[model samples]
Structure formats: C-alpha cells, structure tokens
Target: MTVHSALPDAGWAFTDDAGPAVTRLLDTLPVRPRLLGLGEPIHGEELFLRVRNRLLRHLVEHEGYRSIALESDCLAGLVVDEYVAGGPGSLDDVMARGISHGWGAFAGNRELVAWMREYNQGRPDGDRLRFYGFDAPTEMMYAQSPRHSLTEVRDHLTAWGDAGQLPDDAALIDDLAGADDRWTDEAAAMDPSRSVGSSPEAVRLRLLADDLRALLMAQAPRLLATAPEADRWRARLHARAASGLLRYHAVMAAASPSRYARLMVTRDTMMAENLLGIAAREADRGPTLVFAHNAHLQREEGHWRSDYLDQALIWWTAGAIAAAELGDRYAFVATAVGAIHHRGLGAPAADTLEGVLSTLPDDPYLLAGRRLATALRTADLAPVRRSDNTDDHGFFPRDPAHIADSDGILFLRDVPTDKP
Candidate 1:
C-alpha cells in the first residue's frame, strides 16, 4: 500500500508492469489524489452531479479522503458565515435557504449541495470539512483600474488590515500605511520632468504608486523570500498590488477596449495563480482537494515558456516547494475532461493531436511518427523534448516515474460506463 519511492530524474520511463504499481497505489487505504479542475458551467446540474458522484465515490469509498476543499471565493469565510447564521442547519440547508440562496448564486446545483451536506453530516461536531477559497480579490480589484492613485492603494491596504482577514502585524501595517506619503515626498524632491510625465501631476501620482510598491517589496517579505508564517501576508500584499495595478491599467487602456479585455484576461490568470498558492497553504495540514481550472494543474513545462516564468506553473511549483520546506506531505493530480464533439467554428473543441495530425500534410505526420518511434525506442525520453500535441487537447502526459514517488493520479476523463 506504500506509494513512496525515489522519483526518477526528468526522463526516466517505467516498464509495462507500471500499470499494476499505479493500480496498487490507488488501492491503498489513505492515499487520496486531489481533484483540480475547472469551475461549474452555467446550467449543467446533471454534468455537475455526475462529476461529483465520481469524485465522492473515489474519496469516500476508495481512497477515504474525507475533506473536500472547494476552490470558492471566500470559501472559508463563507462557510463560517453560514455556520454562524444557521446554528443547527446542515450545509445543504445553508446552501439552499441561507447565505448561498440569493439570485445568481450557486443554488441550482442541488445534487452537489446534497452531497456536500451528507459529507459533512457524519463528521464530529465542530470538526466539519474545511473549505478554502483560492481566489485573490486584490488582483481582481487592481484589474478594475489601470492607474491606481497613491491614496487609493493606501486606502485599500488599510481597509484590508482593518478587516480581520489580513494579519495584524503592527510594524508591517504602519509601514504600508505611510508608504503613500513617503512616495509623495520622494516624488516632490525629484526634478519635475523626470519625476513626473508630460502631465507633471498625473505622472507624479503614477510614479508615486510604483515607488510605494518598490519600497514595500524591498522592505517586506516579497514573494520569493522565506519567512515564518509570512505566506499569508505576502499573498495578501501581492494580491493587493496586482489588483490595484490591474484596475489602474484597465482605466488607462479604456481607449482600446480590445486591449483592456486582454488585460482583464491576464488579471484572471494572475488571480488564479494566487488562489492556487493560498489553497495549497490551507491544505498543508493534511490530504486535501484543489478544485481549479484545468490549465492551473496541467504541466506546461514543454511549452514555449519556461516553467518557472509561467504564473500557473509557478503556483504549482511554489506549492511543491512550500510543502518540502514545511516538511509537510503533498502530491499533485492533473484532471482534464474533453468535449464529446466539436460545436462551432471559432469555438474551441476537444480534439486530440492524433486526430488533428490525420488531416495535416503527410510530411509533418511522417516527422511526428518518426519522433514517436524515437521516443518508444529510447527508454528515457527527455521531458524537454516531449511533444505537446500527443494527447487530448495536448493534455500533459503523466510520467509515472514523476508521480510514483507520492501518490497515483486519477484521470477523470473517459469515465467508465458502469458506476461502482
């Protein structure tokens, strides 16, 4: 039942018998592979139910993973709020009639709600399952405007600190609160043209904001720095900075609606990464689930960008790094659900590389075939040289050697016809 083993270096391959070892790990009593996937669709309760059932069966019956960590915004606070409001009600009641019942909320997913209720029903009183929201509001706030005024940034930080959500570090709070004034004084001391832009006042304000952020990064625990119990604080600060900058940039880019749209997309990406980091920290205590976008979990190392530079990849890597640093156990599971059929032109359809390659020129196919031949012949296929278009929607192929060290992964796609 033990899944632990020495991880092979980057390119090692497993033998044909690798399947049994993976199956054995899945058969183990307590090794639960976390579920990381996209959000619920607009109107697909049936689809949601099916997915939830599969996840539940695997966790409760097969792996015995009791906790369900949802990727919700304000998840912990939301649950705590609901619990506080409805003292004796179950989570289902809370979802159906209490806090999560208003219009435009997730009230429609009755089956999923019921499952969550039952999951929490048997737990000891005051020991309910933990729900951690990975969304970072600071990034979202910044995305609202392109050019944040010094006053605006300071106000946002102060408000967050006042709220119990942010840490009550007196020294850190004081430094951030005074950051605006310091930026202004420094800007005032500099030459007008260099310190400010063509519009001296406007440019000065922007420079002041930048200077404040730089000062904070220099003095505070920046994202890369190692500090005790600093992850939460660093996450908050980064989220705030990202959200503020996003909002400021959006306002400036308002002239080009298309460009502004792109910025918003980038902001979402940044927010997702921040949320993943937060979720990872919350789950550090034990085996936990991470519900998020497919893009956030899939390994993108072979793609054009360096793994270290990509935000989502960075988030996953950071979790692994943090787990190791804390001496806490952890494992990653990548989930991908493909489309049944192509819908329309200009719309993304789930098509495999093999399927697409069939329509391409013979020369390219031959080249690809030769590359596959090389890979199969060589036991060790360097990860860097792996092709991105091998599987469904280029889903990152799981290297058993990489994952065998911790726990077996569960590929939720292509679900079996009969239920367990």
Candidate 2:
C-alpha cells in the first residue's frame, strides 16, 4: 500500500495549487488507478456532463465497483423502496415519492438528484443499480426517559395487553416498573441541569429518551457490519475516534484484548469490527466504496501537517491509529472538495465573488456566472475572522487557502446558472 502525502513542504499550508501535487502523486500508482477529482467551476452543462460521465465510466465500467454509497442518511432504504415499488425512476419521481410516501427531505444539491434520475431512468426494476442507506436509528425511546435496547423497547410497546392498540400513559408506567437494571443506572447518571423535571420518574424517562436516541444513531457501524451476506450489503465505518457506538468500542477493545476476557473483548469490539471481519471473510465480494471525510482517511504518521488540522485533529488522529491496527485490506481514499467562498451566513456580497475569481486561472468558462467579481476586485482580505465555535455553525470567509492543500477534489455535478 502506498501513502501519498499531497504537499511535503509545509504541515499546515493551504493553497490553490494542490492539483499539480495531487496529479504527480497519483501518476506513481500501479494498480487500477483510484482517482479522486476535485473540480473547479465550469460554465456549461456540457462541461459538467463531461466530468460526471467520465467519473461514472471510471467507477462502473473500468473499476467494476458494484456499489456506490454516499454520505447520506437513510438513502439505502429509499433505494430499496424505489426498487420494490417499481424499478428504475427519475430524480424528481424519487423525490416526489419520498415526500408523498413520507420518505423524508433531500437536503443537498441538485447534482445528486440529477445523477439518480439519469442513472436509474431506463434500467429494469430488478436490474436497476443497487443503493444502500448509510445511517438509521436502531433504538428508540418513549417520550424522554431511561434507555432501552431496540428489541426491549419494541417488546414493551407490543405487550401492553391491548391487542393492536397503542399503549396509554398507565400502560407505559407499568412497563417502566418492570424495566431493566441498566436503564435505572443510566437514569441516575443524568446531569440535573439540562433535564427539566425534578421528579425521579420524569428525570429517568427524559434521560433514557435522550440516551436511546443517541444509541439508535450510534448503531450504524454495527448494523452495517452484521448485515447478512445475502443481503448484498457492504458497510464502511469511517470515523476518527471511538465516537460511533459499535466500531469505536470494538477497536478500543481489540487494541487491548488481553485486558479484558476474550469474550468480553469480542463483545466490546464486535460491532465496530463487524465490517472489517466480514470483508475478510468474503474477500470475493464486489468492491465497496468507503469515502470518509478528510480526518478519517488522512495518514497520521506522514503528512503531519493538514488543512483540516484546526477542524478535526483529535478525531482524525485517533481514527488513523485504529485503522492501522485493523490492517490493510481496505483502500483509504482522502477526498478534497474545491475552495468555497464563505458568505458570512447573510446575503451574498459583490466583493466575495471577485476575490474567488481573482485566484482562478483566466478562463471565460470559469467567469461565466460571476456577478460578484467586479465588487470583490477592490475589496480588502485583511480582516481574517475567527470563531470559538467548533461545531459546523455560523458563517465565515471563503478562504481559497484551505482548498489549496487538498490532495484531490469532488465537484458538484451541476454548476449553478443563476447568480445574484
């Protein structure tokens, strides 16, 4: 396995000239090339199509990758539902169906929508491309209270002694009276400040409810890992820390196996290690594409300096260590999306566009939709902003510096036509 560090000069330098460095590194690979494209703006639909068609051709025809998973939530179920309902359908059809059938919202760009529409349009229902949902809650809560395992919660809801009838408050009270010891322990651990109620039952239920939701969201890696081989499902656990429910604990336990009994250690790490173990067991299965955000995939030992250092140091570092221990059957791809102009979470100003365009090479295609270039040309970039908020909250300046260090890029399929 080769480790390609994009920029060797500076540890934390962000620049716009990352393409050349990435190209140079990729040219040295011997296997069927795994190329990650980080796109710059292009004017027309033709350019967008050219890029996407090339990408699809490479992934589907050349590479023999049967499954393509996105960083989306519950998308797999939708794909299955669509397949079951009819077969292949358009992007608009899928969205309409999702909304009408209470599927959920499509949160991102039109590129994905367009891609789905085009890819699945003409294919037969059974022969249509396969898609999988990445995340779903495996656990649930009743109001806000002590947590219960998904099975336990489901059972409790089912056995209210009223056949096919939903339980009322009194039934719920009786159910809680017979709750497990773990639920009680978890309830006692809640911080009083955040929870509103002072009563023991109320506090217990609230904390349990919160913890149950947490547990449900945390079940991604485990469920993915243990899914039956016949299910034609492939799972990718991509996180830097043991932050996720199953994989994190599994890796941690695996790292120190002797500290705990073999059975205990296995139990701890089983969910997280499920995918890796399954991959090892079924080496003949078709390739599964697991694209992690930058922090999870970057090599910890080399490329000590990173553009995402401020953004994801702690998690990235830990994930790298865990990945190393897991061995090297997996291909780790680090993605670099192009530079973004931060519009400070308000109305777009004219100057911001000019600053972004100024850094681009002189091309009519690149400047086709630019309305802010004239205003930004004269603006000063002196006031660099800082925020203590670690969360992906608030707006900030669109510094091209960050994109400059990216090893590769992933472009939006559709380039916006209308600009304010």
How would you encode candidate 1's per-residue C-alpha lDDT over 1-420 as one tens digit per residue? 111111111111222233333334344424333432322211122343355445544554444444443433332234433353334656555554432213114432344445555566666634444444444332222322213333433444444332232233322433333333322333222223222222333444445555545544553533234333433344344444444443434333344424333443443454445444544544544344544333333332212232422333223332343234333233444322222222111212213322222222221111111222333342333342123233323233333234332232332222222322
- lDDT tens digits, residue span 79-176, model 2: 44354334576655565443221332333323434554456666654333444333221111101122223224323323322224322332363354
**C-alpha RMSD of each candidate structure in angstroms:** 12.9, 13.6
Weakest lDDT window of 10 consecutive positions for candidate 2: 1-10
For model 1 the TM-score comes to 0.42
Worst 10 residues of 1 by lDDT: 1-10
- The prediction achieving the highest lDDT against the true structure is 1
Highest-TM-score candidate: 1
- Over 4 Å off in model 1, which ranges? 1-49, 60-67, 70-109, 137-285, 301-330, 336-339, 342-420
